[model samples]
Target: MSSSALPKPQMRDLLANCLRFHIVGAIIVSLEVAASYEFGVAEPRKKAYADSTKTMIPHKDFEERRKPGVFQSTK
Candidate 1:
């Protein structure tokens, strides 16, 4: 069968899935940050710098910008 025979996907569903993954990733990152903070592994200066440089994008904006069709950072 040709590729065109496959069913087309909905953008809303794709965005929802991407949002779910992003949320899960953010949770994991937050946990790591918390763990480092608790263990004192991260230096105060580094932590302060990280906190200062952290982006504060809203959830709605993040969801709007993150789409499956574009390249995204998975790190």
Candidate 2:
């Protein structure tokens, strides 16, 4: 109500600064969350290797071995 309390330009500047501060803070928080997700999420799972030199059976041989008559029983 009193002109001496605060001039119009200073009041406008103060209000503008407050709004800008809040907006900048929100943007910073959102960027921080995005950065954290980029760095922290989606780590690749490590496979355990008991014998690194062991080779996998060929697909054709594996299929034939599964057949009952194709593989003879030792007993």
Cα RMSDs of all predictions? 24.8, 9.2
Q: lDDT by residue for model 1 over 3-64, one digit each (tens)? A: 67767767568888999999999999999989888768567778887886685556655666
Any idea what lDDT model 2 has? 0.65
What C-alpha lDDT do the candidate models reach, one value each?
A: 0.75, 0.65
Candidate 1 regions exceeding 4 Å error are 1-9, 41-75
Global Cα lDDT for candidate 1: 0.75
**Counting only residues 3 or more apart in sequence or on different chains, how many pairs clash (N, Cα, C under 3 Å) in candidate 2?**
0
Q: Which candidate leads in TM-score? A: 1
Clashing pairs in 2: none
Candidate 1: Cα lDDT at 7: 75
**lDDT at position 36, candidate 2:** 76
